[model samples]
Target: MKKTALLATAAALILSSMPLSASAAETAAYKLSIDNRTISFPDAQPYKLGSDVMLPLRQTAQALGLKVEYLPASKEAALYGPAGTAIVKSGSNQARLADGSPIEFGADAAVKSNRMFVPLSFFERALGLRTAVQEDTATAAIFTPEQTEAVVRAIVERLVAGEYQQLSDLYFDDTMKQSVPVEALKAGWEQTTATSGELTGTQVNQATSETPDQQQFVVQLSFAKAKAILSLNLNADNQVSGLWLKPIAEQAETPASLIEEEVIVGEGTKYPLPGTLTLPKGASGPLPAVVLVHGSGPNDRDETVGLAKPFRDLAWGLAEQGIAVLRYDKRTYVHGQSLTPDMLASFTVKDETIDDAVAAAKLLKADSRIDASKVYVVGHSLGGMLAPRIDADGGDFAGLAILAGSPRTLWEIIADQNAALIAAMDDGDPAKAANEALVAAEFEKALALAGLTDEEAKAQTVFGIPAYYFKEMDSRGADQIAAKLTKPVLVLQGEADVQVYADKDYVQWQEALKNNDKASFKLYPGLNHFFAKSADGKVEAQVVQDIADWINRP
Candidate 1:
């Protein structure tokens, strides 16, 4: 039982998988020694080790002479030539050919020079050919004529017999890639063995996306037994370029605590913008309540992704903690195409956020169980950023719990921040590849036009959008709204958050609230911007993901 097994000839039937170490067929591990000295900085990890073939896919595919056509209409690719054809769906395994039968193989397919290339071995197997893998060359030569015929014959025989729903030897191919070492996956496999079925399942769903050169399939398969989502990237060459297996249990829906009543915000002509209302169990009488505002984007109340729901967690967590929560879907989710960040400036303070929240607040205030004067605003992220404007008009809210709110005008803060990101570089110095002088010139030109009147601003470009409304944003600060405020303002910051650091917004609040000592500030030590704690809990980590359940709002 060696890791590499000889293909069954048209004469016999056998399926054998041996360990990589014991397999005589194993080639010395390939290391992408593209020194990348200038590109790979000293502090940078040399390379993402393992089977991430960073090499150009087009070069390899052309060497093999495969006809690669990335079909966008079906979101699957058709690859054929000297080797048999394979149909690759975005995010799924590479399809194989066994006469009328098909054998599937897993390897990543990516594009290069406007052409598709696949992982060497995967390309071979999908075409029913025998493969010779060479680590030093990071190449797998094909022996198609004899082996493919035999493979097709053997595969057909196996399908007829139904020996197994799928072939196994999954680890051997991975061992060669060296990206995610086999050890971690083995550990995960063993630890979740008992609970695998509940966590993972496989689906035949196919999705596709256009990369630089060719279109690719984004396939989503569930390893139900493992409770994981396995995403495969199949390029036009029918080779897999990316394979991601993420845990599924972490995505299960938490049963929401039953309370009383949920609300429906406007159903945009496009999608449902339903909202939820949570009340504490029992008791009675008017309770002090707060309206929950979402951050930027067309996020659902829960901000759904595959398995995590941060907003839902927040709403439910707070509701169970005694505070009533009212939150709704963002316009983006409701009216997908009608609204976008590009037109955000066109949306006045009221049409976008304020009016809906105020309407909800007013509605809540009318509710016999909610105290009108005691109503507060709990705004997260962009919600926190926009809170001052809403509070400026709401008049009735007693205070605001601003979470990760940015005090600086968004345009300036965002520009300075992007400048830093675009400036800093490490790998091949991930630094900005764009011409800085050009960008600076554009910036200066844009800002000069920023001084224009509203009508004039509409005529000039600022940050890819019109500059008219944006100039006003530069002069407007959160402190201005706070200056008019006469209530308790609790500024909440996650110490590890970089997006809206405690130093930036908190200090701004402290200085702005000097005359209004009623403004209180607290930092969540371990939390990121999302109030979630993690060493990696910075800008990217804080994105809200709502996945499943009877619970979250997304």
Candidate 2:
């Protein structure tokens, strides 16, 4: 029940009886704008002709600060603008500058109702203007040369000056207005400042136009705590269409005590996963090793989520403490899309997670640098829940480390998340009641999972996933499996974690393995899901030290 890929099949069934010109309305629905102002066409409006949005040349050119002149005898039109003069002949795909340089339109320019119409590209190629056609909204925006540089600079200045409301109100397009409202923009900037400290100054590195329609600016920001980069994108209408701000990651020198090697796990098998082996540089003897497993979703060997690389941290930190760590990319992460529907219908955790982990363990055992008998498995989140099963199915680890993992069923965890969301919703909110009903329906499907046979479970979906996936895991619950195992176990949890509750999941693991003297538990205060002090996502150094100490304990 972890995050699985949603396969979508789209079929276009065309009937002979259907009208060929059914899209005519959509073709003529385009609204043309110049310099952020919509142009009204008294004689000829914009229309699509063979994949190009054709606009009346006379009006469109004049709107873009160009003078239009027609030659009746030769059936040619001349557009004179600041850039140069362009000559276009009716029913021709080629245009020429006054200097006689020919430019291809990619489509023919034609005369309709006594008005010469040209493709949208003509404005960009011939007149040297920027243009964009938004197919979703059926609108095209054209920008004159004078509008690009000054507008981009002004936007950056206004943003750093904290003019979110004015930017949202005046410059934002319809899509940007909805996605990043004034409050959202303000909150994002505030969060950036909160992390990077006070905004000291700003420098605009460069403004570039990769495509004819969009202009991108890379700005360097100086903050009290850290320097960051802000990337701003603008549409042809000079609207703020996209924005991103991220702190520059600090570069740390690699420790000389540790060494790394590129290796492949499950080599010559069905899904060979590439991985990294971090080892103590000057080890005199075989060292104890740990195989790092990932949580839900397709994750790389680094287990990078946003900016955090917990697996890499563990590998490096533990190696610095004289412990070797092997981490590999998940199979689903590498081959999720290639897996067909038949493969997914019968897919379980063993195929998604356990098999790769066991392969990694076997790989460690075979390595000459590794101490085979002292090899351990460290699982995080979903990996944590399946640690016992991974050990049972040929991992044969000396110990197990479960980090931020729960003993509950995956569906039960999902149900808990949904219930918590419902509890937090306002009673009178319109979406609250509807979401409640939806959650209730999914809960019923989850409860009905155990009663159905494998064939029936595979046939029906619960919460948009095959019920058989959950049914398979239900029979081999991690708590039950770990309870029966006498292997040394270390359970670590973050007190501030909202995803898996300490009171419920952490307590349950302790209760399940209470009789085993080898079982140990530790809860971190003020740490979130990744066991970091703040949301910045780097795991606390003490946590790694604790793990290394536990592995090397006498």
TM-score of each: 0.51, 0.59
Q: List lDDT for all candidates, in order.
A: 0.50, 0.77
Q: Where in model 2 is the C-alpha error above 4 Å?
A: 1-253
Q: How well is each residue in 290-315 modelled by candidate 1, as lDDT tens digits? A: 68887765566775423435566666
lDDT of 2 by residue, 147-193 (tens): 66567667767777899767776778765764454544665676556
Candidate whose lDDT is highest = 2
TM-score (C-alpha) between model 2 and the true structure: 0.59
Task: Tell me how far the alpha carbon of residue 92 in candidate 1 is from the true structure, in angstroms, after superposition.
Answer: 46
Q: Against the true structure, whose TM-score is highest?
A: 2
For candidate 2, what is the total of clashing residue pairs? 0
**Model 1 misplaced stretches (Cα beyond 4 Å):** 1-260, 266-272, 304-308, 340-345, 427-446, 459-461, 465-476, 535-554
Model 1 compared with the native: what TM-score?
0.51
Cα misplacement distance, residue 552 of candidate 2 (Å): 0.4
Clashing pairs in 2: none
